[model samples]
Target: MHKKTMTFRCLLLAALLCPLASVAQQAPATADIRDLASSPRWLTTKVYIEGAPQTDVKANYPGVVGISTWDPERNRYEFFYTDTGKSKYDNGGGGYFFITGDHKTHVLVPDVGPTKTMVRRLETLNQCEFTYSREVPRDMVENNPLVRIHVVHAPYTGTVETLSALKPGTPATP
Candidate 1:
């Protein structure tokens, strides 16, 4: 494996496995934007679009998108990905995203069965900066290799962006 690819995977593994508990042994105090226990909740300041999705979902998921509120109680957030063309994807249009974990890390796992969704990972540094990424070999429908990555800063209000900044350097699947 190439060094860059390995490094990226290590980083992702860390993000995916970050602990969500405040009870863990304290070392340094870093802010966890995913921690929605506070009031007002986390809001999307901007969304970024990088590469492209499956041809079928391409029309719906855009380069830049807006995000909805993060509901802690429901552990879910919502967003719509539509191109200016204003066309709809053949799948299920856009569906809701369910995120798991807390504080240290928050991730959108792969969907089982029929949804055919991708795994999205989000790491919000502050109200202004955050990273959202998706690396699925075949998105929405099978055989569509889609990888999206968005490293957003102020003016940061968002959702799905295809592989630009964060896509894996190597093949995601063996």
Candidate 2:
């Protein structure tokens, strides 16, 4: 009987340690954006005019904006735009940083549109790529005109990337 009890205890101990051993073997998470610069996949940055009517305009000029670095510690992507003026039909118009990984891929959230948001997948980074857009009316042709758009291969030490071409009203895909 004592031998049987000892055997059971040994089996239980082995099961508990197995998970811990596997976790220990895993690599540490990537924390900086520079680490992803050398990767092969193309990072797509779409910039939509804030308030442009007609889905066609938005689709054609789905502004290819700039790229920002991912701060794993903060879990956010710092983005900058060129259109400085404030308007009803403007989405990506100023310099601001968005939550990293949150916008990695295109996600369709309701109340925004049928397919409201579109995102790109970052190869090594665990976060989603993001894009911005504005609501539009059916009749409005030039609801918001994008002035410029840019893309940065990697995050700069201290500078922010610029976005251009203010043609608004691009519907996002789910």
Q: Judged by TM-score, which candidate is best?
A: 1
The superposed Cα distance between candidate 2 and the true structure at residue 148, in angstroms, equals: 21
Query: lDDT per model, in order?
Result: 0.37, 0.30
What lDDT does model 2 reach?
Answer: 0.30
- Residue-level lDDT of model 1, residues 1-174, one tens digit each, is 443454456446655555433443222235454443342322333333444322234334343343233344544333333222221222322322334334343443221223333444554544445445454434334577765444332332234332211123411210
Runs in model 1 with CA error above 4 Å?
Answer: 1-64, 80-105, 109-118, 136-148, 151-174
Q: What is the clash count for each candidate, in the order shown?
A: 17, 30
- The candidate that wins on lDDT is 1
lDDT by residue for model 2 (1-174), tens: 643454355445444533543422222234334344332222333333333222223334423433333333332232233233122123432121222332222112112212223222222232232223223332234665433222223223333323432234432110
- The residue ranges of model 2 lying beyond 4 angstroms of the native Cα positions read 1-62, 67-69, 82-117, 123-152, 157-174
TM-scores for the candidates:
0.37, 0.25
